[model samples]
Target: MAELQTHYPDVVPDLPDLYEPLVLFYERGGEFVRDNAGFLDLTGVLFRPGTLRGHLGAPSLSTLSDTVLDAVDAEGRISYYTTADGQGPLLRRRELRDEQRDELFSRDLQWEPTDRIPGSKEEAKDAGLVELDEIAAANLIAVILSNTSR
Candidate 1:
């Protein structure tokens, strides 16, 4: 783990497309956008499962799946993940940093707590927040088949 951390630039190519895996699920090769059959797949960027966790500290696929699967309701339009509505628009306090950023993702008292639900925004933050190195969605696709051959 330490070795990968030390020599990451050499061993692992930066995956801007794979940055926000939650937004764009990992696939070796496929259409960048596919808003059909339930999933709004913005896939195309992919990394070997082992390499991802080892090199870039991405969550294990299982961990990711567990986190995302349920939150996505049947409609799939809204799926909440770790960190919801941070600090309510960053209220002005002379400086951005002084805007109480750390307490941003605090679970709202209004919402019933489920004792640390798997996909809660808190879990995503607690388990090491992944800063997404990702591509602009518009550049990729306008609704295409994920696996045209399949």
Candidate 2:
């Protein structure tokens, strides 16, 4: 287990430069960040997309805007957050369109109303479970804190 730096108050324990891994994680949703404690964050620094591209070796790992580090949650993924484009509050435009088309085209089923569900239970459950299968976990590169000692 990687230990936090307690020797000096000012010194943050050794952390790998995981800028890339984090971005990959975000694309899926920050599942790893939730599971692991003391995941080093490069929050204090301001790294532009271009700079990150140079290091992370990807063009679409991030956007031009800075990251919302605090955004990392148990279900960390893009779908968890509200995006500018409303083409999908559910999925991509084509996928969303297909799903919507299915809903529009299919015969509406007579659903039973329950005390717990004042509205459409299936729709509500589907909406709520968006995070369940939406974002996948990314494989982060483990940092070797011991290497820093040498």
Candidate 3:
């Protein structure tokens, strides 16, 4: 807390209570950020598309602007596809392989609500968890905090 306050005097005080501990835990590099229950809950709460959109003043696509899409494509780290109806671009993964050479192909992929638990698709749906990319969530929080501090 002292380190955060000393390093980010102007910004630290403005951060909500829910955000501070997680930020500190992450800064300490104790372990995987996902291992922190508070961080996971914060991610589930604030990183959802609806919640982010609200924080971003209700933009049509929140932080997912065309410029961001183009930049992501230019980087070539991932591939994104546009919907035929022009809804938005989506990250499409064809396959992923584990250390054992077992493959999870596109057809075999099942969208689970949360990675914290093992459950059936129906159970996942009932869990009501919002799947969010950790890096993306961190970026979103930074953006929001930056904007709010000003």
Candidate 4:
């Protein structure tokens, strides 16, 4: 975990709770960036069309974005995506393996409502958690703290 703090040093985002993961959803470029604890995990990033295959190396684990977007529950059960875009969309799930201790994959997630009022998809992504606006606010606070640490 020290490696994560040492590497980003000044860019670590604050999370809702110390135990909860902080996820970043990119609007224009359909992608998700996730930070768990002190380690950076990219198992859940998504891509649009077939362009995902071209961008698998740097950001996420796989480059194949040609997957149909589907939603599954945290228990690994097939469930409907409540989100507009997520509805009936076919999605591919990939597990990111860690070489060290047991680590959590970014793919392993369940959608909980964020306090952010939804307008556009981008707005929703930037809004942070569905039920926890405070978490989003904490991330903003983390950004400020990270800057000071630098």
Candidate 3, 1-150: lDDT as tens digits: 667877999878754455654465456442332433334333122333236547656322233333332222221122122233422222222222331111111222222222232243344235442322434433343343344457
lDDT of 4 by residue, 41-112 (tens): 323322243354675543421211212111221222111212333221122222234311111112232233
> Where does candidate 3 have its weakest 10-residue lDDT segment?
99-108
Q: How close is candidate 4 to the true structure, as a TM-score?
A: 0.15
- Model 1: how far residue 63 lies from native, Å: 6.8
Backbone atom clashes (below 3 Å) for every candidate:
4, 3, 0, 17
Per TM-score, the best of the predicted structures is: 3
TM-score list, all predictions? 0.18, 0.18, 0.20, 0.15
lDDT of 2 at 9: 36
Ranking by lDDT: 3, 1, 4, 2
lDDT of each: 0.30, 0.28, 0.34, 0.29
Report the number of the highest-lDDT candidate. Answer: 3
RMSD (Å) per prediction: 17.6, 17.4, 16.9, 17.3
**CA shift at 59, candidate 2, in angstroms?**
10
Clashing pairs in 3: none
Instruction: Give the clash total for candidate 4.
Output: 17
Candidate 2 lDDT by residue in tens digits, 13-94:
5654456555765775533222134344332212333354485554222221222222222211122211223222222111
